[model samples]
Target chain A: MEHGTTEPGTAGPENQAVPDRPTPTPAPGTPAPGAPSSGAPAPVAPATGAAEEEHRPSPREQERERFRRSRRRRDTWIAALSTLAFLGLLAAAAVASPGWDRVHGLFLDAGEFRAALPEILQGFWLNVRMFLVAEALILVLGLAVALVRVTRAPGLQPLRLAATVYVDVFRGVPTLLLVFLVGFGLPALRLQGTPSQPWVLGVIALVLSYTAYVAEVLRAGLESVHPAQRNAARALGLSGSQTLRHVVLPQAVRNVLPPLLNDFIALQKDTALVAVLGPLEALRVAQIKADYDFNYTPYLGAALLFIAVTVPLTRVADRLQRRAAQRTRAEAAR
Target chain B: MNEPLLRIRGLHKRYGSRTVLRSVDLDVAEHEVVCLIGGSGSGKSTLLRCVDLLDVVDDGTVHLGGTELTDPRLDADVARRRIGVVFQAYNLFPHLSVLDNITLAPRIVHGVPRRQAEETARGLLARLGLADKERDHPDRLSGGQQQRAAIARALATEPELLLLDEITSALDPELVGEVLDVVADLKQRGMTILMATHEMGFARQVADRVCFLEDGVIREEGTAEQVLTDPRHPSTRRFLSRVLDRR
Candidate 1:
């Protein structure tokens, strides 16, 4: 750490603090470490306009730089140690069987993997449709149930309890059991014509199961709305329903968007559960291709398809979350 | 002169085992401003809520402008429309723009046309010194601005009685003056305000009558000058002393 010096773009310690600094190049003809003037410590302040490019450091900033150096060294050592361990494991696995060579051969053929893409993506589109429909149903049903639960009306208590029990039972049961129950048990009960198709049953199952979880999300969202909002609306002579529709639901919905998007992503992946009911979703397509071709390339193709959809959606959600956080921070600063 | 704007008789409320309001009685003359002041948990808010039918009294009669508000047989909704309330927290809807927040109730509750409601909302916003903020959400406004917008929202219906419950309590020290100033402006314009406030200075300056509540009952009631400057009740003196010492 050293005393202050003028630097045009640099902010003082009290203002505009940031974590990183790019290294500035030293001037030409600077003395090396063991040169004639190196015996004494360097003087910080000089006569007016002497190069004016020497870096100034405060005591705290100097300590921080030293700490940063040590931490970087520690991280570098950890990375090197982990890399060595991974190489050793790879060597061991390779020696155990027809190993690293096979793995390399499996991954290096990009052409074979790319050929199966059209078939995999066809199934993946159907999976997307199933996810969207299920998520829409879940969101609407969840919001209605959450609203009923928060209502002050005594008559809605039974309805609210029924919704709660429904959410608990559906969420508590495994998604596979739900798909099976809808696909197999519904036909046995003679509830529908030929139990519908497996894809339909899968969608129904996902909607039912996910709605329970989404309802809790909506409940939390509704709870996040301040009570004064409701009170203010009521003071304006609005009815209970009007107050909820006008004042509570809109804000609650915005607060719940990120989590709701996350649920949609989860539902997208979980659509593979349709395989249990016997439709070809992305995973099922991968399975069929693997079974027919007797190769792992088709499965990899399907994995990439799933990643393409999910990764972009996650990025969008992340951007929205950051914007929301920034808005909150700005409001706090105000 | 036919009936008082608000009248409460034999009002009672209890929370679990502890009684909060015990047979409270009060009346507000036509277009009169009444201030209810008390220590915490003294039930001023509860009594005020009961008058608006926001809370139902155990055994009481609450009449607003000659219509019985707490009567089980009457249209409580209609009675409620005649009274507007402002809470301590401003309570503006965060999702809606300032214009929408002010107009939402009129359009939804009273079946006012959107165009007419918007016009009325703009007028109220202008009156509240928020004409330029109609497009902004509540989060964009300062605490004082939000409270003022909330007051405009409550007044959009032209309610016969305005109930304000600690309207400035949630404001920042710098913001409190702006909110209290609005309240003072309202008082001067002869708005029939029933406020439960901790602002002793504002109460002394504006309130027509001050009622001191303790243990769910009015311990003392008098003109603002007499009640604030020359309190006869020991509890009132104790309360004033504590509040004054802090200042």
Candidate 2:
């Protein structure tokens, strides 16, 4: 109690002469020392100056703080220990399986995978080329369809209806069926100008199927823009096409960028379906090698190649999605 | 009076059997400031919107500066270029800078050169007290600053008539004064204005003529002093009293 009184006197010379500041510090330090001498005025000064400086917590507050700290430490240890135990149990179970030797011989043959790597890499280049060409076509086709579907002009109603039907029909049909139909049916037509190349037909089929899904995603973004914005643009004397080209499309594309990337990723994976037409894509090459060696490890090599390309793209899309969400929240707060 | 700057006769508007404006007629002389005052559903906003051709009239004619504006054969975009409109909530394009919002119409619709349009936009921005905010987006501005920028955008085209629909209704109490001051300045410059407002005091102070709308019609019309201080209609008195009581 004496040290508490002396500490305040040393901390501030003005407090020693004030009589009010020194009285309160000592009363809390030694509450049972004397009530009438210190307790009466002590409560009033501290209550008013509570916010001015940090004070020692009461026993109840100290106990609550200690409980919270220990609970946080316990939660961290429980989570970490449970994750380690789960992984260990899985590994132990895998080692003790009766079919481990046979499964390893077929699927995990490291020598067979290494032997197939060079040819799989060469075949993967074809898949990449198809993906790049199809992606460009999909962007243009999808944007055109979305623009037509969103048009409000009375004269364009027929075009809008046609675009709607195209999207519905294409999205309903599977990509593999589209590839088969375009690859086989176009050649069967025997049209003079149509190319009979399977890869070209494969690219067209991928674009046709993916454009429908991407257009719907873009249309959702366009519709989310408030109608007030359209009214403002119209009131400013901007024509419908000018408004769409400048105001509406920029905002719409920005809003739906992550979803557009997701569709492109799906397109990349679906390029493998082109193999049904006898193209030497990564998957087809892997299947041939696996059948020759009587081992499934080449399939694993093809899967790894696909994963290597897609994982970076997936990470980029996730980062962009997070940033867009953050920007939306900040705009809302403003 | 040298042909009214704007004329509306037999204007009718309805939304699926619910009539909003029924055979409304109004006239505004050049350089005159007319204010429309009404209750929530009194069709003040609808009448202004119809005059601007933002909403199509069921049956009517609107003439601006001796040119018929309601003809269905006329290109609405070309016609809209001659008029300026400011809305409640200050609908400034959120994605563009203040200067770009002001210059978009003149550069795109009127075919003004980019540098010339930007010069005019900068002058308007300076006059509106937003000289330093030319490059700032709408979300970065206060409500009053955004409304002032909206006014600058509307004035950039040098329109024959300006339509303002409750411009100060969306502003904070302190911010409302700055927006009203811009309107007062526009009136001083003799811009032809047809505005709808809920601010009774401002309407009385700045308007040359005031029209009281009630249930899809103008119930009373006169000079601002006459309609606001000594009304001829009982509904006008009731509406004013309710508005004044809240103040």
Candidate 3:
């Protein structure tokens, strides 16, 4: 999906700019001097020297400046053209559709959207609460599992195997199925002391599935730490646990922050999945309103709310990843 | 004269089928600087690692002040606390500020109070000419400054013996002098040290004794003047001539 968007966005500029290069200054290989050819050999040296002095900026610098200017112009044209093309396609599709007005009435009616907002907003609060609880639980569980997987002690083999198995099974099972099993199947058994609330069960399933993925991310981060750091920690007389706590885990956590945030963003969207159990979360509220009013505007409203919550979070993750890359580059340069 | 601060008797180290150290025996007295000179892959680093109990030796023994360090029953962490080591590269923790790197061992390993550890760390940093860089991370420092910070960290715990394994080998030629100057300063302060290096000039200048190692064995050992200037073994003579000729 990313490749599809970026390819045309960049290719348009290059294609438009290429023809302009060869037309002007066609003999790029030849260096032109303003020296008049003289029959006398002595004047040749002085004339060429004078010609060289007359060239204010070096040819290479001049060409580079020209290239920069052309590139800027090409970028501007690409942006304008791509925007026009995209809007034109949408307009053409709207004009060609046989039921455009009916589709618009069903999906874009402002009155239906306004009527759905209050209940959907209330439902979104439940999603927010569940996401918060699930995120915290997942972080703790993920770090514990990652630590167990990375520990090298022979005595902890059984514990390591169990943690590994937990990760594998949870990661392999579709989250939707796990949600169904935990939220619906478990409560059907009528076990004593079991909390049968849909929201609680949904949060449990989300935490279980996310912990497996986040644990693998954390494990990769732990493995990425240089062996020298561990050697230095051990040589300083720190015990294995102390070395991990003080030396390894801090660096690993920093390395994995972007991915962990990505996982949280996914969890935020997945909060809507609780509607499968008939809980009146945002999506469920939207579904009921759409069915009652016979308008899809409520579904669009719910989607917009999800986007509003996730976009800023994604931007934050991007900034963090950029900063991390910059730090590594600076370290390498040093 | 005094009981040797570190002793290795018939130390044998192997990785799978290949032996890195073969029946190597050496002793380092208190306040003495012993330099190990050899070509690459000649067991210099392996011997130093074995002494620090970083590497489990296949056979033989390592003793620190007459206590057996290599015994299987001994706790390696307790033995390692008495020995400080600086590697060729990435010696300082990049995640930590210079001061934190220096004080980590003292505070965590020795159970020193935070205030005392910071005090010692600041003094060491000042002595190493990095007093103003205490708050800076290792990545922000130049290679020379990073190495100096690493040395200060190694010295912060005041270990009984310091092991430096090719510490200057990874440094640029211009930066090598500053790190060697720190080692020379440590020697003047009478720190017991065992170092491995290819820098013959620095070794000749700073080492009290020099041992020439060839194929995991000590071919010649004596004072710096005798071993470096006039070696008895044919292999040592050839190695030194080749090294000097390249210079």
Candidate 4:
């Protein structure tokens, strides 16, 4: 059936239109965007018939609006209180500590502490390189593992089982332990050589360890797509692969992005875990600089570095979660 | 008058040790709408699934047009593409907008171009009264809109036959009317529709023929008025009484 539309004035009293014969009248009674009500007299039959059918807001829609208003109220309170409390904490901590004076000097003067913004920035670039490379590897490997685990092919069972076991072992074991094993244990096995730089070794270790956990996260997201979605695609005559490509994977990945972003923020913190491998990630730079200065300024600097990296990532995660939540609630109300 | 568009014979299915559908026989003429009504677990849905080839029947033959679909020499994949099945659950792909859900099958399976399919999908969505929801995902749609989208999704394939497994049962009471209105529209359009439904009133209103299944067997079959209002078999009367008592 083609979508039929009627001219705007066709349904007016003087131009009363025939109803039920596929007259395109903008679906009777639908509020057209930005329409100025001309007080046009209502049509006689067809328009009135459709008006009776389609104009009312469904009960589900009514319930959804109620739900949204209640959630808005609750979220407003949470937002206001958290902001005030955080500001209060910052003020109290600043008042209790005059140690910030020395910390300020360390940042401004390169001569006194042997620590300058340029040197720290060089380390920051290295960290950025490491994260980008690791994330690329993580996405590809994790997606492959996720697909392997979710596929229905019989011969792939062993591969799927192995992926599951691998995910379980890696996720259960401490990331710190896994990174150590990658950096140090491979040399004992005589299978590979450790990279020359501690930073290089740290990147490899972090990537290897995190990839295992990320793969499982990806699998969970893939599985979150409802079975009905797959069935609907199949009913449409799509091949199994086509169904996955067009219907299943797109939604699964969208549903999982919030969690994936959460994982990314955790990944930033996990980069600090590379400190054990001796890469001059933010934490390692702070510790090395603190040793030279005989002061805790480097340690405080590391905390600030993490806050800088994490705050923006968390905001993105928050936005994703809010959208995901609103969608979920709307769907539930339906 | 016309040769049947669909024919089912000696259909039998089992799950583990439990027999869900016994040997059953049925047929549907081209452009005819047949409604299957029975109590829960009566195998009406299972029969629809088998006909659509969504489930591999343990043993049976489903003939589409003139082709024997379940024969060992026949390809199940090709058989499936010829039949479109709408589930009771209205499984609209949650990620795709309503329009995408309708367009995807035609584009991917039938090899229709994206632009043509989009136009067709937009047409169907609008006809189903979901024009405003074209950009909204399934999760954002009401039960009726979602079911209508499911219907549009099935029709997008241009399948000769449509298998509806209680598509309106999952809807809220107020929403059932809209979904049934779509079904009525399809019926009036001369689409071949075989529906398994719990909506006895809608079944009476739309079905050309109504079949009653009991204990996985077709207990009775007759004209809609004959079967729904004046059933002759004692078992059919008992079933009708039970259905009416609930209302």
TM-score between candidate 2 and the true structure: 0.84
Tens digits of per-residue lDDT, candidate 1, A240-269, equal 777778778887878878887888888888
> Model 2 over residues B1-247: C-alpha lDDT tens digits?
6789899999899989999998888999998999999998899989988877789989989999888889989888888888899999788887789999999899988889999999999999888888988998876677788889999999998898899999988776777888898899999999999999998889988999999999999999999999999999999999999989998
Order of models, best lDDT first? 3, 2, 1, 4
Q: Each model's DockQ?
A: 0.28, 0.28, 0.32, 0.29
Worst 10 residues of 2 chain B by lDDT: B136-145
Clashing pairs in 3: none
lDDT of 1 at B149: 90
Residues B137-199, candidate 4: write the lDDT tens digits: 665455677788888888888889999999878866777887888889999999999999988
Q: Is candidate 1 or candidate 4 better by DockQ?
A: 4
Q: Name the weakest run of 10 consecutive residues (lDDT summed) in model 3 chain B.
A: B137-146
Residue A295 in candidate 2, Cα distance off native in Å: 2.4
Chain B TM-score (model 3 vs. true structure): 0.98
The chain A TM-scores for the candidates, taken one by one, are: 0.69, 0.75, 0.77, 0.68
Off by over 4 Å in 1: A1-98, A105-108, A152-158, A189-195, A320-334
Alpha-carbon shift of residue B150 in model 2 (angstroms): 1.9
What CAPRI grade goes to candidate 3?
A: acceptable
Clashing pairs in 1: A2-A57
Candidate 4: deviation at residue A124, Å?
Answer: 1.3
State iRMS for model 3: 11.8
* Model 4 / residue A221 / CA error / Å: 2.1
- Model 2 achieves a DockQ score of 0.28
Per-prediction TM-score to the true structure, in the order listed: 0.80, 0.84, 0.87, 0.79
Positional deviation of A239 in candidate 4, in angstroms?
2.2
